[model samples]
Target chain A: MALRRQVCFALYAASRATTALYRPLLDELGLTYPQYLVLLVLWERDGRTVKELGEELRLDSGTLSPLLKRMEAAGLVERQRTAGDERVVEVRLTAAGTELQARARSVPAALVAATGLDRKTLVELRDTLTTFASTMDIAAQELAAKKK
Target chain B: MALRRQVCFALYAASRATTALYRPLLDELGLTYPQYLVLLVLWERDGRTVKELGEELRLDSGTLSPLLKRMEAAGLVERQRTAGDERVVEVRLTAAGTELQARARSVPAALVAATGLDRKTLVELRDTLTTFASTMDIAAQELAAKKK
Candidate 1:
C-alpha cells in the first residue's frame, strides 16, 4: 500500500497538519499544541489530579510531567500536592490561564473556518475517528494482556 | 462546543492513540513513528531528495535534517550531496534498510489487526482524512493570503 493511502499515515499527517494550522494561532497565546490540549482539559474542569489529567489526555506521567512543568514555569498553571492526599498532584489554571480562556474561545471557531468543512461533516468525521480510537484502545489492551 | 467534542481534539487524540499502538511493533525495528514514515517513503522510491521527502511527508527541513541524521547514524540510510547538484541532498536506503523491508511488511498487518477495523473501513477513513487535510491546506493558504 502507498504510504499516503495508509489509514495510520493519513491520521498522522492530518493531525500534524491541523496542529500546524493551529501553530500561529496558539503561538499568539504562547502555547504548543499539546500544551494547548492540557489547558483545554483544565479549562473544562479545574484542579484535576495528574492521574485525572493523564486519563483525560491519554498521556502518561513521563510525557505529562515535563509538559506540566513547562506550563507551570510559563505561569499559566500551578501544580500543588493535595494536603489530604500527598501523592496526588492537582493541576489548576492560574489567573493568567483562566483569563487566556476568553481569547481561546475564538480558536475552535477559527480552526473550523480553516477546515472549510461544514459543521455536519466535521462532526461526523470527528465522531468516526473518536470511535475508531476507542476501539483501538480496547484492542491495545488485549494485545498487552496477551503479551503478559 | 466542549473541548472533548472538538474535531481537532478528536483528531489529535486518535492520532496519538494509533501511534502508541504502532510503538511496540516499530520498536522491534529500532524505528520511531516518524523514522518509520521516512523509510516508508524511501522503500516506495529510492534516492529521493530531502525536499521531495519533506514534501511527501509534510515536514520542514529542521525536523527532517535531524531525523535523517539519526537514520544515517543508525546505518539504515545514507545522505549525500548529489554530484550533479551540490545543493541537493539525496536519501537512499542502505542494504540493511532494504533488507529491513521484509521485516517491516508485518508492521502494517500487525497494526491492522490491532485496530480491529476491517480493511475497507480503514481505507475509507484514510481517504476521508486525506481529503480533509487537503481542504484544510487550501483554507490555510487562503487565510494567509487574506492576512497579507
Candidate 2:
C-alpha cells in the first residue's frame, strides 16, 4: 500500500523496525529493549529518580516500576529511598549494570549496520527526529494545559 | 546526556511522542493508536489476510492476533475464513469501522499541527523514515538468513 504519506505511520513502523533490530542483539546481553533504554539513561547519569527515568523513557510509573523490579532481580539496577526523603525512590545501576556498558558499547554500531545506513546519515535522521519529538511534546503539553 | 547521538533513542522517543499526541484524539474515537494504524491499512484495501496485516504493521501474530480480536469485538472490523481456504482468515472493516474513516480524516492534520512542523518538512521526515525502515528490514532479513 502507498500509505507512506502518513507521517505517524512512518514513525511507528520505523520505530518498530528499530526495536526488532535491537531485539536479538540485546537478548544476548540479557536485556530487553526497554531495559537497554533504561540502562542508556543511567549510563549517562548514575542515579536518577524513578520519576526522572520515567520522563526520559516517556514511560509511566506503572510500566517503569515493574521494569526496574525486573532489572533489580537481574542484578542490573537497585531502587532505594532517598536519604533526605523516604518517599522519593531513586534508581541506580549496580556494578554489574555499569559493566554492561562495555558489552553495550557495540550496540549502537550494530544497530547502525542493521539499518544499512552510514553513520553520518543516521546521525542527521536522529537529530531531526529528536527535534520533532521535542516540538510534539511542547504541543501536547500546551494542549493538556488548555484542557486543564 | 550526549545520548542524542543514539539513533535508536531518537526514533524511539519520536515515535512515543507521536503516539502520545494521538492518544487523546484516538481515545475520543474509542481506538488506540495501533488500532488506528490497522484501520489505515484496511481503508487503503478493504480485506487482507492476517499475515498481510501483520507484515504491513511489522507486528508478530502474537501481537496482531489479539489486536484484531479486540478490534472485531469493538465492531470496527470482522474476521472470517476465506471460502476457498478455511485456514486463511481475512479481515474486513465493518460499517462502523468504515464510517470511522471520515471522522479520522482530521487526525493526520491534527497530528501535523501537534508536531508544529510544516507539512513539507514532515513529509520529508516521513519519507526518510520509510526508507530507513525498509533498509533496516532488508538488513535484518539478510542477517537472519546468514544465521540460518
Candidate 3:
C-alpha cells in the first residue's frame, strides 16, 4: 500500500508540475491542459470522429462532449457530422487552429526550461511511464474481457 | 514533445487507474479517493490544520476547505479553530473516523487483486515514481524560490 501510494503520489505530482509548466504557456494561447490535449490529438490527425478522440485520450463521451463544445466556441476546432454517419460527430481543426501550432511550437523549449529536469531523467521517466501505461492498458482490457 | 506527451499520459493514466483501483474499495467504506486521502492523513496524525493538510496533499485551500467541510458533514472529522491561532482550522478524526481504519485495512489488498499487477512490478514502479517525484519536487521548489 505504501509503495502504491508513492507511485500514485509521483504521478499526481508530475501531472501538476506538467500542468503548471503549460499553464502559463497555454494561457498565452488561451488554452487549458485538457483543451491543449484535444488540440494535440487533432494536430496529429485532423478530422477524426469524436469517438476516436475519446478512445485515444481514454476519455468517455461525458467528458469529451462538453470539452469539444467548449473548443468549438473557442474556434480552435470545428465539429461536423458526415452525411453517411449522421450519428457520429467528426472534429476538424480550423485555420486558426493550424496557425496556433506555429505559436505553440516553442512550448517544448519553455517546458524544458521551466521543469529543469535533465534530458536523461526525462527520457527515463517517459520510458518507464510508457511501459507502465501499456501494462495497465492491457490489464484493464483483460479485466474487461474476463467480466464479459 | 513525444517525451512530454509520455509524461503527461503516464500522469493522467496513473491518476485514473489509481482512482479506479480505490473506487470500489472506498465505496465499501463510503469514501471517495480524495476523502480517503484526507482520512489517511488524519490516520497518520489527527488534529492537523487544514493548511497543513493542504500542503501534505499538494491541494490548495480552496479545494481542501470545501472537502474538509464535507468530511465534517459526513461525521468523519471535526474542524476546530486553534486557541493559539484563530486563523487555523484543526482537523481531528471523530470516533467514527478512527474506527473506519479497521474496514479500510483490507482495501489495499482488494485494489492489488483488482489491478492484477505483480508485486515485483508494483514495487519497481513505485520506486521509480518516487525518485521521479522527489527530483521534480526539488526542481519545482528551486523554480518557485527563484521566482520569489
Candidate 4:
C-alpha cells in the first residue's frame, strides 16, 4: 500500500495542514501553535503547575521550560516557584494573557470559517480523532509496559 | 464547547502522540521525527526536489529550509540546486542515507509490534481518519477560493 495514501499519513497530513491554517492567524497575534495551546489551557483555568500544564499538553519539561520562559518574558504569563512545593513552578496568566483570550475567542471561529467545513462535519471529525487518539494512547501504554 | 476536546485538539494530540511513539525507535537511528518523515518520503522514491518534499510533507519553505539544512548537515542527504531551475533544490540520499534505509525497513514492523491495537481497530481508525482528512482538504480549498 502507498504510505502516502495510508490513513495514518492522512491524519498526519491534515494535522500539519490544520496547524498551518492557524499560522497566518496566529502569526498576526505573535504566537506559535504550541504557545496558543498553552494559552488556551491557561485561559480555561488559571494557575496550573508546570507538571499539570505538561501533562495537559503532553509535553516534557525540556520543551516546556524554555517555552514558558519565553511566554513569561513576553508578559503573557507569570511563572512563580510555589512556596508550598519549591520544586514546582506555577503558571498563571498575566493581564495581557487574560486580555489575549478575548482576541483568541474569535480564532476558533475564524479557523472554522477558514476551513469551510460544515459544523456537523467538524464535529464528526473530532469524534473520530478522539477515538483514534484514545486507542493510540492505550496502544502506546501497552507497548511501554511490554518493554519493561 | 470544551475547546480542549475538539477534533482539532484531538488531531493535534494524536499527531504529537504518533511522533512520541516513534521517538525512542527513531532516536536509536539518530533522527528526529521530522527528519524521519523526510527519510520516509525519500525511501519510497530516491531523488525529490525540496518543493516536492514540502508538498508531500505539507511543510513550507519556512519550516523545511532549516530542516533540510540539518538533514544535509547530518550527511544523510545532499542538496543540489537543479540545473534546469536555479530556484529549485533537489535532495538525493548519500551513501549513508541509502544504507540507513536497511535500518529503517524494520521500523514499520517494530511500530506495529509495539502498538497493541488489533488489525481490525487499526483498519477502522485508518478509514475514519482518511475520510476526515479528505473532507478537511476539500473544505480548506473551498475556503481558499472564497477568499480569492
Q: Which candidate should be chosen as best, given lDDT against the real structure?
A: 1
lDDT of 1 by residue, A1-148 (tens): 5798789988988988898899889999999999998988888889999999889888999999999999999999999999998999999999999999998899988988888889998889989989988987887788788989
- In candidate 4, what are the lDDT values of residues A22-137, reduced to their tens digit? 77678878899999999988888899999999988878899999999999999999999999989999999999999988777788887777565688877876776676676667
What's the best-to-worst order under TM-score? 1, 2, 3, 4
**What does the lDDT come to for candidate 1?**
0.90
Assess candidate 2 and give its lDDT.
Answer: 0.88
Measured with C-alpha atoms, the lDDT of residue A137 in candidate 2 is: 87
Residue pairs whose backbone atoms clash in candidate 1: none
DockQ of each: 0.74, 0.69, 0.44, 0.43
Across residues B35-74, which tens digit of lDDT does each residue of candidate 1 receive? Answer: 9999999999999999999999989899999999999999
For residue A92, give model 3's deviation from the true position in Å.
0.5
Query: Tens digits of per-residue lDDT for model 2 on B68-124?
Result: 999999999999999999999999999999999999888887877777788788778
lDDT of 3 by residue, A1-148 (tens): 3323645565666667667656666888999988888887778778989899887787889999999999899899999999997999999999999898889888877666655567787677677666666665666666557769
Tell me how far the alpha carbon of residue A64 in candidate 1 is from the true structure, in angstroms, after superposition: 1.8
Which runs of model 3 end up more than 4 angstroms from their true locations? A1-5, A137-148, B1-5, B113-124, B134-148
Q: What ranking emerges by lDDT with the best candidate at the front? A: 1, 2, 4, 3
Per-prediction share of native contacts kept: 0.75, 0.80, 0.37, 0.46
Q: Which of candidates 2 and 3 is the stronger one according to DockQ?
A: 2
Task: Show model 1 residue runs off by greater than 4 Å.
Answer: none
lDDT of every predicted structure (CA atoms): 0.90, 0.88, 0.76, 0.80
Candidate 3 residue B54 Cα shift, in angstroms, is 0.8
Cα lDDT for residue B116, candidate 4: 58
Give me the runs in candidate 2 sitting further than 4 Å from their true place: none
Question: How far out, in Å, is residue B101 in model 4?
Answer: 2.8
